[model samples]
Target: MNLNSIHNVYFIGIGGIGMSALARYFVANGKLVAGYDKTPSEITDSLRALGVEVHFEDAVSSIPKSCLNSESTLVVYTPAIPQGHLEFEYFKNNNFKILKRSQILGLITENTFCLAVAGTHGKTTTSSILGHLLNECDVPLTAFLGGICENYNSNLILNGTEVSVVEADEFDRSFLTLSPDLACITSMDADHLDIYGDASELKKSFVDFSKRVKPNGKLFVRNGLPIDGITYGIEDDSDYSVQNIKIENGSYVFDVKTPKTLLENLQFNLPGRHNLSNALIALAMAVEYGCPHRQLANALASFKGVKRRFTYQIKTDNFVYIDDYAHHPEEINAVHQAVREMYPNKKVLAVFQPHLFSRTRDFIDDFAKSLSQFDELLLLDIYPARELPIEGVTSAWLLSKIANKNKQLVSKQDLLKKIHESNAQIVLTIGAGDIGEEVKHIKKEFNVAN
Candidate 1:
């Protein structure tokens, strides 16, 4: 538990977004770091650039000798890693000090002034904004984000170690381990049904997380969430409210009403009401933490956003291509709203890949409803992450349920061809699976950028 005493650290899923941030943190602190992942990715390449040893094989031989010491080396594994994994079994049987990624994150932030963002959605963007805001205000803080912030080009924001900002994840009840001085629940939408089994249980977990805040700590919730906290919303009576919202030149210019005063004409460039709400909560938390309003406003305006969330691959007057990591139905609806608002007169073609089989089965009707709103739809086969496919659950089945007449079930190979035939002015690639890997190919096919 004493991180200072540990000289070497190993990760079982080092290429994961959250896990890679931890790997970078340990490397920056002068630990001999090495790990195993199922595949190579941009994350693994960046870690290698930082001198961390990473291997794709699962054999125990891939582990470095320095990590064999039980007392000196600590093993951090993500929940996605199966229990039958070879390196995981080796660490288990050899009496190594193994810990889940969230447990180690909890330990790292326990002694610091921790500001944690917890919810089913908005965890990544909200926490990234908070980290940026505090860092801009010159607060000595270390932020561990769940996604790569475009502003920093890395998930781990290392300004100082006295304060810590973290995305409090709810998957497998991981957020329960974090006891924060300031926490916010951006949403409580039912998700990860494979883990919680029901929506009520997921709500219970968020309630439990709200209790994890330290005494005298502040908890902020979205305006209408079923929780007691200082509330924030777009334009309503709440402790932190945004008013006079206007979109000019593809950016938001608004005003924020805080508990004590109003911040006028604040600007944020991200393209969703959901993202604006995210910016508001981050600003609220920074304000409550005693950060200067002028500095926080400046920081929020400058936040570039997380990489896959509403990232514009190509933007021109004739055509637009956007990529987003919106796996859930609600998230998809938000993306639809933002896109339609931005280009009301143009036609849109949405290409979607369902993330998990269980999730697809759980919300099939909602998925169909959301996807039906686009001018055209191309549905890819489900990406079964950590789950076996259920009988009668497939992309074709979901596509059949879609009320949109323009929808089609398509293969990855023919995706670009189908897109080429569409006359829509705007195109979207939306999902949280290997669909993201396809972004580069899609970008290359466009052959132009604005």
Candidate 2:
């Protein structure tokens, strides 16, 4: 299955962030690219703008005739696609060369020097930062990221063929497909319990991923994670660590202590100590890839963040609005830490839409505790991405566990009205669901009030 032999690339779930990145990659490489998604989205629109034909309909007829050749056309699909999907069934029955998104990433990145970032959280941001650092350092690199990079304004970063940076996704064990020259596990938090069933299994999967690093390649893991790798952490003992960190003029100013030397006064614009850890891991990896120390520092300063990962929508003195894709308890805790460190006195209002019913059921207590840190809370019903509704798992049930007195469950229709009525200075909408689609409206409403 040589990718060079393929003339057309068809995606079954092209609207997904990771899938769209691959679509862009194929289209950029001069291949005929088209796909079907369940719904139209900004991502699909962007792919279409790039000359990749995208249709929202799921009917088998929506697939282009160009993709009919089973041998020359590559059919890629996300695991989230249903087993009964029409286009999927068409490809399956026709004996098309089908590949999972991760398998395709592995195939494309095999010959290149791959820097794979793997974890339950922070994979997107870490990979995006690494890509930016390499590009700024003038390293000939290409990065396939899982989120839209604000600096490049695309999930796929292309420069040269020598190096490839990618997000090593853990969902559906996708990261296992990648054979990385250098890999980092930013976190191994228990998630996707519907898949792994427990935290230990999730940890074992990460351990297996770490072992997948090439014999001579490097593996970086966050400190204290249950794995053997060169460790990274914030102001702690690890092979690479950030120390003397301070927020200066709205950016994080810190020093990274690596195995060889201490890179001082490193500047990262992203917020949070967890982000600082992310930056440190990216910096270390870039240096290992032969990027100069000074170059790493410069790149860190210029690296813009990933969209929806602690993304600041509005940053004015009077009002601040942030949007994050934190769907788990550990991620929410990181967000809480960032907000408290930045605006200690400001009243914070959090609007969270739980991602899946299974996750909500597994970590309801943890979610309740993390969300309680907010001064006020507005909880939306679960998003249920690929899960059937579990009995007794509802956002209202989770909201009831929150200790905050200023908490209520609200519908999307009344979300804006509730925000307008609140006196909180820092407003955050946190989730890994359709809540992001509402960010623009929330920002517009705040701007109009201002």
Candidate 3:
């Protein structure tokens, strides 16, 4: 558990969003870091530019010579990596000290005053805002975020060790490994049903995570989350709440009512009421940690947003396009709500790539109902991240249930051409899949046409 004993750090799935953040942390701390991934990505390219050796092949020979020692090298892998991964097995067979990404996170924050953000959907945005608030307040802190913060341009926010911030993920019950001095749960919707098997079990897992907050620490939950703690909501009876919200120049300006004080004229540019709640949670956590209300408001104002979380690829006078990583039904519904608010009565086309086969099977009807809200739909094939295809679950099958007559199935290869042919003024690319990799191409095609 002592990180000081580790001289070299290696990763099996080094290119994963969360795993790459840890890789950056190790490299920034001056550790000899190297790793393997199944493919090259923007993350892998970034790691290589930092002089950390990264390989696509999973062979043990690809392991750097400096990372082979059992006593000094710490092996980290994501849950997405299979149990039979060769490099992981080699590390196991050789008795090298190894751990899950969450275990290592627990170790890093074990000594620092930790602030953990846990939820089914809003954890990344909340953690990013919280990290920005702490940084703006000049706190000695490091935030291990789930998504890349656009403000910092990295998932791992670099700072001194007095305090630490992290996204407390629930997959594989990973958040249970953390010891947090302060924490917040944004939402407790049924997700990762592949792991927990049912909604009740997933809710129970969150309750267990709430108990990990250290004695004398605070736990903030969104109002009505069924947890005993300080609560935050928009226009609700909660410990922390937002009031008098209004949109000004494409940004939301609102007032906050906390237990001790009421702060007004808070501004956030991110769309949706869900995001307003996210800002409120971050503000609540930072205020509890003693960040000045004035400084927190300034930080919230400057917060650009997380990449791929309602990201704008093209926003011009002629056309508008947005891409999001909203895989769950609730997330898609939030995207729908945001779009409806921004472009009400305008023709909009939704191009969605369902993330996982298991998730599609679990929420087929829900997905259909959510996607049907748009003016038109172009459904892409499901991105089977780690799961094999379910027998009857496919994008075409899900498309059939959609109540929209404008819905049709489209392949990724044909996506751009299909988009260009559409008469709709606004386009939405929504999903948590490899569809993100195609954003650059989509933007380019639109730019050329315009």
Candidate 4:
């Protein structure tokens, strides 16, 4: 089970965000890395640029010959990969040591001083912020993030061997595999109902993750979540709180109050109150890790956000375009609040692509309510990532529940023409599926219009 003895690492679903991050980590550590993905993507292209061998075909023959040794080569696969996947079955039949993505992450982080971020939403942004904070402070840290960080332009950040930062994902009970020295639960909203039947089971998973923290370690939670941890919130009486908030020139200027003292004049360029709370938790965790106060403040000030998390594609006075990976009701609500607060009185149009059939079925009412806040809505069909189609779940069915009169279900082919016809001042493309791949095209169309 020793990683040091492995000479090669192969991934069955290599194009995934988390899987790509681990691929980068193994390659950076001087191990030969290769993988098979169902499709080639920007992530796969980036890995190839880094000298990792990646192939699109999922057959066993697609695997490199160098990875044939069962003892020296370790195989990793994501939960999204099906049981009948050819490469996966090949690896299993050969008796090679195989691990799930989460299990491998748990193994890699076992000996390091780990800072794990867990939540139904905000796990990626929170972990990325913590990674950037630690990196800016020059801490001896390594971070395996769930998204591409805009600051480093990579999901894996390696600084030193002393500490590690990870996004504790809750899908399929993934976060339970992690043993963290310092952990935070950013939210406990009901999600992934296909995996955990109801909200109570989801909350129990978070509680279980909290218990996985080292006995002497600390856990940070949002003020209202049902968990025992140091609380963080904005303008609230939490252990670590953000107060004196002001928005000047589209940036948040706030002060953080910790148990010992108040850190004054904290500046975060990211929009929304949710991001402010994200920053506060990151700051508190950095301080707990012994990062200097001034260093933490400086890091927060210079921190750039993660890609697809409230990412600004085109920001101008006349027109604003944002892309966010908001797939859940609560996340969509956060995006709505952020957009409305930043550009009051401006006409806003939202284009959302539902992620999964089960999720859409479980929270159709909630999604309808959250999406109704938009001035205009463009709904796309559901993006079924890993689930079979639910009998009654469809984007049109969900769209029918929306109270907004200005809503229409559009195809991807007509998306650009629809946007061209709209006069909305602010446009947001929100989802956690292939909708993101359309951001560049949408931005190009906007640029041409200008």
Most lDDT-accurate candidate: 1
State TM-scores per candidate. 0.99, 0.98, 0.99, 0.99
lDDT against true structure, model 3: 0.91
Q: Where's the lowest-lDDT run of ten residues in candidate 1?
A: 441-450
Model 2 clash pairs?
none
Clashing pairs in 3: none
Question: What are the Cα lDDT values of the candidates?
Answer: 0.94, 0.91, 0.91, 0.92
Q: What digit string (tens of lDDT, one per residue) describes model 1 on residues 148-225?
A: 999989999999999999999999999999999999999999999899999999999999999999999999999899
1-450: candidate 3 lDDT, tens digit per residue: 778878999998899999999999998888999999988999999999999899988798888899988988999989898768899999999998889999999999999999999999999999999999999999999899889899989998887888999999999999999989999999998889999999999999999999999998999998898999999899988989999989888889889999988999999999998888898999899999998888888999999999999899999877999999999989999998888887777789999999999999999999999999888999999999888888989998999999999988999889988887789999999998999999999999887777
lDDT of 2: 0.91
For model 2, where is the 10-residue window of minimal lDDT? 54-63
Q: 44, model 1: CA deviation in Å?
A: 0.6
Off by over 4 Å in 1: 448-450
* Candidate 2 residue-wise lDDT, 45-88, digit = tens: 88889888888888877788899999899999999987688889
Tell me the deviation in Å of residue 106 in model 3.
0.4
User: What tens digits encode model 4's per-residue C-alpha lDDT throughout 1-450?
Assistant: 899999999998899999999999999899999999887889999999999999987777778999999999999999998768888888899999999999999998999999999988888888999998888888888899999999999999999878999999999999999999999998888998888999899989888999999999999999998888899998989999998998888899888889999989888999887887788888899988888899888888888899999999998889999999999999999999999899989999999999999999999999999999999999999999887898989998998999999999999999999988889999999999999999999999897776
Evaluate candidate 3 by giving its C-alpha RMSD to the native, one decimal: 0.9
